[model samples]
Target: MAWFMGAVLLLALLTALLAPRLLRLQQERQERRADEHYRKQLQAATDHAITTAVRARLAEPVVDLHITIPMRVTVGDVIARALEDFALEVPWDHAAAMLRHRLEFRGHARWPDLITDVFDDEEDHTP
Candidate 1:
């Protein structure tokens, strides 16, 4: 019948129109997953390198060192300030208090706990 033929033609037309879009969306999802995996891999590698360098420096002989601390502001904090009545500026000694708070509260939460792996020998250690 003509109606049955028209229904089949409409279904085929819809499939032809939607198939490429569906395929493109699937590809984009795959690409995003790949990007995230790559980012995590890169971060882990950077953390390892930094940890090794710090450990190597600490193992060296004592020397006077000067450190310039930076004020790191997060986007979450900025958003919170925009939403709430948070003070834009705190009282003096904020820097010192922040340092103390980080050392006391956050110092123990370091990941990959040991700087040097137990299985690593001095000769095979990364610097």
Candidate 2:
């Protein structure tokens, strides 16, 4: 009877000594899982924002043009140079004529005129 009681007391003491360590480990694991979940959510949101911005930028209208000019060298042969670029929206009507003049006077001739022609052509082609 005394031996049975002693074993029971020993088991209770061991359980008491180990319970706090087990509880602490479980709590740490839960916190780690929560942190991982939050990081994943933040990364997903950042990716979505970047994708949206890229799509918006791609949706903007862009035009590409290529120009070539040739020049004769004094010492040797002829040289040819090519220029290529893009143009965006430009308004070119009577109401916006002054704006167009200002832009052209600033040496943006090819760009402004090309953009204006594009808008005009689009309007004419629209049904």
Candidate 3:
């Protein structure tokens, strides 16, 4: 009886010790999967997507003002808009900052000028 009890206690102690590591492994796997998904999304993203994504993220959700926020524009739709706009390629975080800066200091009035200034293509006019 004593030996059996000792064996049972040892098993329980071992399981308790091992549980945290197992949980950590599970969490790591989830993070890896999430990262992979984000990578796939970034790959399929277009240049102007970064701009609209930033805009949507910055949008205010006002409740009492009779404002109902809508779902973010689809990635495919943003890519199509980018195709129409001829925007420059930018990394996600940088694009967000640039868009914010443009909206703040430059405003929508000079948007086209700002794009031309920031992403100048001298080659286009060289010929």
TM-score of each: 0.43, 0.46, 0.38
Predicted candidate 1, C-alpha RMSD: 15.8
Distance from true location, Cα of 105 in model 1, Å: 16
Better of 1 and 2 by TM-score: 2
Go through the candidates in order and give each one's C-alpha lDDT.
0.44, 0.40, 0.50
Which one is best on lDDT?
3
Supply candidate 3's per-residue lDDT for 100.
43
lDDT tens digits, residue span 1-127, model 3: 9999999999999999999999999999999997776544443443345456546645856655564443243334433553455443334343333434444453442433223222333343232
Over 10-29, each residue of candidate 1 has an lDDT whose tens digit, in order, gives 99999999999999999999
Q: Mind giving the per-residue lDDT tens digits that candidate 2 earns over 19-75?
A: 999999999999999767644443333333333434554565555435322111110
TM-score attained by model 3: 0.38
User: Which candidate number would show the highest TM-score if scored against the true structure?
Assistant: 2
Collision pairs in model 3: none
Full-model lDDT, candidate 3: 0.50
